[model samples]
Target: MLNGKVVAITGGFGQLGVAVVQGALAAGAKVAALDRAPAPAAASNLGDALALGGLDLAEPDVAARALDEVARKFGGLDALVNIAGTFRWEELEQGSVDTWDLLYRVNLRSAVSTSRAALPHLTRRGGGSIVNIGAGAAAARAAAGMGAYTASKAGVAKLTEALAAEVKDRGITVNAILPSTIDTPANRADMPKADFSRWVAPKSIADTILFLLSDSARDITGALIPVSGRV
Candidate 1:
């Protein structure tokens, strides 16, 4: 369904990002993987995917540069998936200003910067899609020490809604996906005793992202879809 399209994914080297990059490529879309980390050892599995170094999302200029580079390399840009983010598990008392700033920079500011940078590209293409990854914890009350993380995600959700309204008439769609607890390798290693089966899989999330980026989702905008696997 994504044939001939070019998709840009931030944090494209991480677990979920890997799934998205591979998935997009398999679906016949030109994939641009953007991440602060370098590309992993190339495997025969990735066909024609391209990896690009991305800057800290909080840096406005970096966002613009990344988008420009994508447009130049791919001839045009079709979709942007803001999968870059930071997570911290700290109590309210233990949370320092630096921690709050760092998380906000990665989780919230990155999406804002990326969306703004990709807007003109999407407009020029006549229409496109932006998918922001969010956390479900933002919908519930604080969990004693997740105040800052929760607040950052709340900002993401609100930003998605506001941006959707701003770009709806321009043929662009903005939406956020709230996943409860993703079953990533890091999460599995961190919580060995947890039920891995209950956690949402990275490929599953990527599937949803692919759907939203496809032409079939042209009418779906401003929606905060939940990808929590029965949690």
Candidate 2:
């Protein structure tokens, strides 16, 4: 059901973002994949989709220009997935203030800036969807070393709720997905002793995100859908 939709995904070069971009294309949507890092060589031939790199989503003005460019190139814009964010593990006392600052800039700022940029274009479509990636870890009582990261993702959850209320009348739906321990290679490396089977798969998360962006989920907004795989 996303056929003909022009969807944009931030953090498009990442493992999870790569899953999302490929899935969106498979579902017959025109896609614009944006990331601070360049696209992998394997993604060079994405048929007609746009894959751009080095575009910082933290800068609202730059994000607005890029989204406008996407609309111009893709004919129109329909959906955006703010999957760009960073993760850090550090206790409050052990962490430098810079860690907090870095987390906010990379996680919260990216989503806020890009969602603000994409809102008008989505509204121009009469209605559209915005899906954000939040961590389930953020909702639970803070783990010993997750203070900075959790706080930033908590901001994302709040942003989703508030923005959904703001744009409900405009036909734009804003929502966030909270996933616990995504089964990515990086996570596997970081937590080598953990059970990988319990972690959520990138493909599973991508499928859910795609569904949220489809017409079927048009009535769903401000929902923080959790995709934890028994974690």
Candidate 3:
């Protein structure tokens, strides 16, 4: 579906990120997987996808450099997937303000900085798609311990809307996928007794993201689509 497309995905070393990278590659796109974590030791599964690690995407200079490298390697950029984020369960009363700051930096700021960096390249391609990973919790009311995480994710949702409008005339589209508790290994271990069947799968989210990036959804932008799997 993405043949000849050059796509870059942030947080590409994690479970969901890995799924998206593989899916994009299968769709015949030149993929670049950027992450703050170290590159995986056995990345043969990533095929010819470029794996760039130790990037702090919240920093504008860092994000710009990373994306510049991707554009240099791929010849151009056509899509971006912002999946770098973190979650913390803590009540405001018990949590340090630092938690909120950390979430903001990692979740919202990272997306903003990376998207800003990618704009020139995407514009040079005449158009491109940007997909962000938001949270279903943020779309709805926050639970007792979800204030910080939800707040950060809500910022991401708002960024999608605002940036989409700002770049629509430039032929760039921006959207976000709001997912419920994803059924990853870490989530399973955290909620061992929970019904794993109800949680969304990483591949499910990846498929939705791929659709958003393709020409099939070229007219869709600024949409905060919910991809909750019965959650």
Best by TM-score: 3
Candidate 1 residue spans exceeding 4 A from truth: 44-46
Give the per-residue lDDT digits (tens) of candidate 3, residues 1-231. 999899999999888999999999999899999999987776455677899989999999999999999999989999999999999999987789999999999999999999999999999999999999999999897889999999999999999999999999989999999999999989999999999999999999999999999999999999999999989
lDDT of 3 at 125: 95
Score residue 96 of candidate 3 by CA lDDT: 96
The C-alpha stretches of model 2 lying farther than 4 A from their native spots are 42-48
Task: Score residue 208 of candidate 3 by CA lDDT.
Answer: 99
TM-score of each: 0.96, 0.97, 0.98
Q: Using alpha carbons, what is the TM-score of model 1?
A: 0.96
Q: Who is ahead in lDDT, 1 or 3?
A: 3
RMSD of 2: 1.3
**Weakest lDDT window of 10 consecutive positions for candidate 3:** 39-48
lDDT by residue (tens digit), candidate 2, 184-206: 99999999999999999999999
Q: Rank by TM-score, highest first.
A: 3, 2, 1
